[model samples]
Target: MEPGTHDLRVLIGRQRLCDVLFEGLGAFMLLMSLFILAALFINLAIEGLARLQPDFFLDFPSRRAGQAGILSAWVGSVLVMLVTAAAALPVGVAAGIWLEEYAPKNWLTDVVEINVTNLAGVPSIIYGLLALGLLVHQFRLGESILTAGLTLGMMILPVVIVSTREAIRAVPQTIREAAYGLGASRWRVTRDHVLPYSVAGILTGVIIGLSRAIGETAPIITIGALTFIAFLPPAPVSAVPPFINFEWLSSPFTVLPIQMFNWISRPDPAFQSNAAAAGLVLVILTLFMNAMAIWLRYRARKRIKW
Candidate 1:
């Protein structure tokens, strides 16, 4: 071979070798991440599995020497999770839709966008402090379930907003154009075409956001979510003669994280075991939400035509 061709062949071989090295490094990193995750799951299971029992889900916390279960905390966590979803979903989705579909390209929108990006990076504890001031002190909501839910709603709003916008943006522009071609108004196109297409994405984002909100303790604690509540929240709503009431809104609630914190802080070995059990429950709840989000996304992908 000519000398020039020989050098070119050598260069190509060196490039291929470099590519192989980089690919191997990437694979190694990916494997490392999986290993870490598996180890964590194993550790959590080892610590918590022994305490898992039906009674753990059926009894309420007791300060009276030996009779304790997490029933009230479980109920409180459910109420808080539901309330957080109720408050965050509509507002976050609306904000996202407006930003992605309607907001003018202006400095004001730019500023709002920047602030939202920053807010997502803000520490959870900062949101907790904000909740303490705004909900507990100013609003006098007094560590109630509503206060905790609202605080978490605010904490996760940026995440929901960002995810919803991405979902909305992913809808094909051709669909919107087709709607308009049919003489549909902008509102009609959004309501009928865009919104339906984006529903799965929106639901997935909402579920993931709620999962994070459900696991959070800082913001709720800041809003004074109780460490223990003896009572289950009143059924979501009531319809007695001449009155409609949401008693859950006014009730004090305890969540798994708060209960775990209380248990883990105690001197008793049994309480430590209880904390591990509560941790296990929290992990299961988060995993269930994640699975649902994955299922929704899979369905959405299956339904997409293009």
Candidate 2:
């Protein structure tokens, strides 16, 4: 072969080698992830399988690991998530809509956008400290369910807003123009044309944000949420005519992660088992939320055409 032909062959060989190297690297990374997850599941199962009794879900925290349960922890988690969704979802989505659809393309808008992105990347512990100083101290919310909700809501707000903006941006400009041409105002266009196409993505983002919030231990801990609680919050339902109670918002709370942390820190092997059980429950809850979000996204994609 000529010199140039030999060089070309060498180049082809190097290209093939690079492709094989990258393929192997990708496979190795994937395998590593799977192996780690498998190890975690196996360890948790070994520790917690026998402890997954019905009473484990019904009872409250106790000194004895066998008597301790996740009742308050899980309930508090649910209540906090409810408050978080109620607080963050509307504001985040509205902010996103304003920024994407209505905000003037000016320096102020650009600065605000930059800040929001920065907030999303801020350390979770920093948010905790901020919540500790601002909400717990300044506002006097105390270490209650409301405080936890507010802290997590603020932490996840940027995630929701960014996701919502991206979803809205994904709705084609032509769609907005067509709506405007049909005599629709900006509000009407967003309400009818933009939102319908983007609700799935918005919900997906919201749920993912909530999942992150659910797993958060730092901020809530920073705000001084109790790690062990033997009692439940006041019931939302009442026998009287005004059948709802909001008093529980002020009650002390312990989230799943906090409770799990408490157990995991104990010297007893039984407490370690209990912690694994709690962790497993939390993982299941997070997975369930994600699955619902995925289903919503799938349905939205199938139903909404360009």
Top candidate when judged by lDDT against the true structure: 2
The C-alpha TM-scores of every prediction are 0.88, 0.93
lDDT of 1 by residue, 1-306 (tens): 566988999999999999999999999999999999788777777877777888878888887424678898988888888778989999899989889888899998999899889989999999889889988899888888888888888888998898899889989998999999999998898889888889889999999998998888877776666556777887865576536457778888899889988888889877777888888888888999999999999998888875
CA lDDT for candidate 1: 0.85
- Using TM-score as the measure, the top candidate is 2
User: How far off is residue 279 in model 1, in Å?
Assistant: 0.9
Can you tell me which runs of candidate 2 are displaced by over 4 Å?
A: 1-22
lDDT of each: 0.85, 0.91
Taking the tens digit of each residue's C-alpha lDDT, what string does model 2 give over 42-111?
8888888888899999999999889999999999999999999988999999999999998998998999
